[model samples]
Target: MLVPLTREKFEQLIPLIATGPQYKYYWGKFSNFLQRLLISVVIGAIVLLFKVLFRVDFPLVFIIGIIGAFYWFWGPVFQASQRNIKCRRYKYSGFFRGRILDFWITEELIGKQETVNNKGDLVIVENREKRINLEIGDDTGFIAEFQAPLKVAYKAISSGQWAELLVMSNRGDLSTIEEISDIYIPSRDLWVSDYPILRRDFFTEVSSRLDDNEDEDDKPRRRRSEGNRRRKRDDYRY
Candidate 1:
């Protein structure tokens, strides 16, 4: 299902900027905080070495302090700005309803982790994790493939399960999809992605409204048989 997102619907979706998982990005995660601290320490150590070796005057304390302060305060602000820009980019987006054509999982190496062995040696171990892949399509003949971290809910997803997305198109006709939001599975009440793209509450409300309207318009009605009508007309003419 595809519906053009009008100005009214777009306004309703504006609140999404302040909702969902704000810490989905790297800059908003705790690991980024630790990385910044490590970087500041390394820079401080380099400054100390320079002062001892060349007798150069550099405010080592002030330099490291500034770096730490910038990272600590600016990271979240930058992440928010990025998200806002993204949401605005899809202001003219359309709503899409599709079905899961297929799904599977594969193992991939993410990175290497460091650990100490019983022999008192540090070793790097490869980190491998399973990622779920899904193929979704709709009546419009558009098909899309998405892959993300494996979630427990994904196990229950089978073929023909319903899914939803926010689709961006460059044309007014909304014929071609330029971008898409993370897939939302209504059956599982799960958004199948590592990061959240849509505001859960608002998205649910909008989807429910659209679904109800579609149901009302698609209700079946009885019609007289065309073959019987044509036979009666021919008999009357003869």
Candidate 2:
């Protein structure tokens, strides 16, 4: 079933910003930063030791760095997947209906911080381009938040446009959307009922009943009837 999300309903359902302070990069604000620095130093020492001991250009060290960065940046999703695998889990989820409160698209130039204003429109203030984050909110508060790409943020989504975000609960990840469009959910019962009408079989039966007209040709009348039936069907749909 296609359930359209109007602007009012969208605002009502979407969540607002979480209360209190939050650690954007990692858990345990101060300790996490120290731990990260210590880990980086340890890794650097290990790289140096490897170079001294092996006496070889470790070209693959950069590859390991890349992989580590990937894991660190997306640790939640990777950890969730590992947990699901251990538990032998499977899952199903309902369509999350929400409007595009706003969206952030990355660009090469510098960008700024965006906010949901009093009019419920997403706005950005001109500034530096180092930070990256997107906040989705409703009347209650901000519901969803995701870190965006590194660069200028382009096109904060307009307020009150209907949209549905399909998600997989099993292997959750920061899978971003490229495009969105209407998705049709067909009903078996509706298809069976409309098969005859769509096939113009009703006109076939009407033509058969009119075959007894001897003085006049029934083909013209049948064609006319079929055309009328098609027009009626179109009008009913709209």
TM-score, per-candidate, Cα-based: 0.67, 0.25
lDDT of 2 by residue, 49-129 (tens): 776888867679756655543443344344333433332222322223344455454443465788999999998877644
What Cα-based lDDT does every candidate model obtain? 0.70, 0.36
Q: Which segments of candidate 2 are over 4 A away from where they belong? A: 1-27, 65-89, 95-238
Clash totals, every prediction: 0, 8
Report how far off residue 124 is in candidate 2 (Å): 48
Q: What is the overall TM-score of model 1 with all chains considered together?
A: 0.67
Which 10-residue window in model 1 sums to the lowest lDDT? Answer: 229-238
The best candidate in terms of TM-score: 1
Over the full model, what C-alpha lDDT does candidate 1 score relative to the true structure?
0.70
